[model samples]
Structure formats: C-alpha cells, structure tokens
Target: MSYDAKVFNVMVASPGDVLAERALFREVIHEWNAVNSEVRKVVLMPVGWETHSSPEMGAGPQEIINQQVLHSCDLLVGIFWTRAGTPTTEYASGTIEEIEKHIAAGRLAMLYFSTTPAVLDDVDNEQYQTLRDFKASCRSRGLFESFDSLAEFRNKFSRQLQQKLNAHEMFKLTQTESSSNQPVSDFMRLTVPSLTHEAKVLLKEVSQDPHGRLTYVRYIGGAAMQSNAKSFLDSKERREVAKWENALQLLQEEELIVERGHKGEFFEITAKGYEVADTIIS
Candidate 1:
C-alpha cells in the first residue's frame, strides 16, 4: 500500500490587545512554516495585526480576522500571556464559537502556552485574573499546553510535532522486530518456565487418580484430557477450564506422546517430551 504525506494546518490565537503577544505569534508561525514543509498552512486570528493603515475599514477588523482564521485552520494554538490584557470580550466570543465549530467538525487540536506577567508591562492584576479565567475554561474543555517562556514554547512545539509524525514509524519498527525469526533455543528459554509450571499442575492432577495405573490413564481419557475440562477441579475452576484445555491442546498437537488404542491408554513420553522433561528436572 502507498502512503500519502499528511499536511498540518495551524491557527494561532493571541490576545490582540498585547503587542508583544501579537509579535511573538507572528514570529513563531513564520519560523515554523520556514522549517517544516509538512505544515502547509498557518492562520493568525485578530490579535495578529501590528498596525492598521486604514481607519475606514471599520472598527471590527479584529473580529473579521478572527472569523477568517477560525474558518481556515485545523488546529488551534492559544498563546496566553496573562499580563497582556484579557482578550477583548469580542475576541473571546469569537474564539469560543470557533472552538465549538472545530469540535463539531472533528477538526481541532489545541495547544496553549502561558507567559509570565512580570515580563510584560501591560500585564496587570486584572489581566492576570482574566488569564486565570481563560486557563480555567481551557481546563474544563481539556484543551491546553503550557510553556514557561518563548524559548520553552519553541522547543516543546517542535518535539510534540515530531512525536506526532514519527509515531507510526516507531510502531512499524516494533512490529518488524517481533515478526523476524528467532532460534528454537531462544524460544525454549523464554517458554520453558511457564510451560514447566503448567506441566507440573497437569501431572499433579493426573497423579491424583484413585484407580490403578491402567485405570488412571482411562480416567484421564474419560475426563476428556484432550478437552478443556482439566480445570474443573474446584468450584470456581470451571470458568478456567477452557484456558487449561487450550494449553493442553498445544502439547497434544505437538505429539508429545502416543495414545495406544483405548486399552486404558498409556503415556510413553516421546523423545521431544523426554528432552523437555529432562531440561525441567535439571
């Protein structure tokens, strides 16, 4: 089967009221696009503009950009600088609505980054409170990522993106390693202990026959030793019979012993069984 390269669309949401946050968002998207060809699209919401030349465009330029940004992207990246004044109520409304739309469409993954209030001048007590509210909102919706600084954000974003991309490759490698053949000795070493414990339990049950040696084998056969009934020894044991029977079937299917026509069947261990038994005893 052929695989197609996947394209990632990123949308950045920032408190447009803060110049520093707007600048940072722009810089990050620009740098990300330059480095990762897979990230085919990047859209920034209202807080993205630096300065507007035309006042005639009307007062709702930010709202218009917010709507456009939401419509264009698949993933939303929220940059939270608590010190930056809370996004205007209008910005918050637009973001919340966009988030709902993305969720309904099953097309959204969200990441959040928070910056220290002390680092930005406009970030005040009221702004911090607004950020706390925003953080709480994100937590309730289970949409968040956190960073201590811009540098941290850069590092973490790259790491997360790489992990998302390489996950399938890693899984495929694990499957390949598991399927490659291994030596019988290696298989024996891994399987013997558990097999020995199981054999001991089965042998113990066989040894418990109240009849003579010939009748003992007969009892085992009558109990359908070839079936899963070996686990029916106790009150709660019936449920586990199928599991025991499956294990027993593996041993029988390997021809570990020959069954002579039902004159009280006798078990003469095969060469394979003798080798396995000797290994267990030693």
Candidate 2:
C-alpha cells in the first residue's frame, strides 16, 4: 500500500466571497491528482487554513493560522471576488498577507481575481476598492489571471496545473542531470546549504520549548527565550540580532519552522525542524 509519488501541497487562499471558487478549486485539485498522479508520479494535495488549523491562542488569530498552514504550502492559489477580506496589522487582509508571504519566499503564487459584475447594493465600495488596489499590486508583482465565471476559472486552473506539473518534471530532470555531473563533494555542498551558528542556536532554543512554540516578537527580547537563547546570542558578534532575523528567514525557507503572529511575530517548531534539531542535540 506504499507508493513513492512526490506530493505537492497546494494552498488555496481566498476571502469569504469566493465560496464557489474555493469549492471548485478543491474539485480541480482532486481531478488533477486522480488523472495525473499515477502517470506523473506526483500528487497535489490541497491545503487551506480552515481545514489545517484548530483553535489556538498566543499571537493574532490569523498569524497562528499562517504558521500552521501557509508555511508548508508548495504552491499558493489566491482567489478574490468582491470582498478584499478583513484588515490585518500588516496587510489589508489575511489573504493578502498569506499570498505575499508565499511569493516572498521565491516560490509560485497564482492569483485569480474575479471580474464578474455584482449588484451595486451587494458590493462594499471600500472593500472593492481595496481589492482593486491589490489586483493592481499583483500586476506589478507578477502575472495574474481573471475569470468571469467559476466554469472559466476551472478550465484555466486545469491548464495551469498541467503546465506546472510539466515544469516540475523538467526541474527534477535538470537537477538529476546536474547532480550526476557534479562530484560527490560538490553535490553534497549543493544539496545542503550550511546553517549559520546563530540559526542553529535559535533552533536549539526553540527545540527546548515544552509546548513547541515561541512568540515571534517576544523571542527577540531576552526574557522570552530565557538565558538559553540569550546566553548563546550574547556570546555572538554585534550583528547578532540581524543574524537571528536571517536565521528565522532561512528556517522558514527550508520549511523547518512556521510563523503565526501578525507581521510574522509568532513561530513554532515544525515537525521537520524538531527532527533536525533533535538529531543535532543528540
């Protein structure tokens, strides 16, 4: 019952208005996996905060959701309609924050803004304006598509998903060829990027947490991590703070840790991160 197929987690991020689009997204992803998984040797798993996260407290609610769900996504699909989504401290809405974070990681983020006309009374002028601004921002950031109906979105998504799979296959092939040509030592170096001492120290500190979570902003303060993180950090150079920040970003990119607080102020040790740190500590 064990098959070796590469699994890609696709995060579907959206606001309240796009209920139909969200449902269609799940259907499309299911179809993709069913049709393409066997032949392609890959499966696309759809992920979203609503399904992935349970109730938790500590940082802002949205931040916690991000840490749990957003960090693990291999690809992000953002859908927007009349609603721009509720405001957050950092971005106009949580969806925006999620999409931006995913894109900032130098990964793929596909945004679909609905252009279908709506009744004047049903639309919130302010919310629509915010959505417009975000759509414009998307144009500057990357290419985005629009659909007038759910049917259209479904068709477009299927084509796009196929293209993505094709690209993934090419990338794997390239990596395989490149690795084959490189020396063992060179391949090892290329595969494993060295983790900085500060990053290791921070990971070590978080690894000690009984609850397996840390307040993102508070961790910057000495008291949050107690003498453990502080002691190690204090022994380092004057740029320790910057090093810590860099470590967090690196851990994030490596999918070793997840952040949950607004403006990325909360973090927790992901299972993968914990395993790595456990090995190091042992």
TM-score versus the correct structure, for each prediction:
0.41, 0.60
Candidate 2: what lDDT? 0.72
Candidate 2 stretches greater than 4 Å from native: 168-282
Clashes in predicted model 2: 2
Top-TM-score candidate index: 2
Q: What tens-digit string does per-residue lDDT give for candidate 2 at 155-218?
A: 5675566666556653366446544655455434443345787677777676665444555444
TM-score of 2: 0.60
Tens-place lDDT digits, model 1, residues 61-135: 555554545555656555655543334445343444445566667764555556544545655677667567766
Worst 10 residues of 1 by lDDT: 209-218
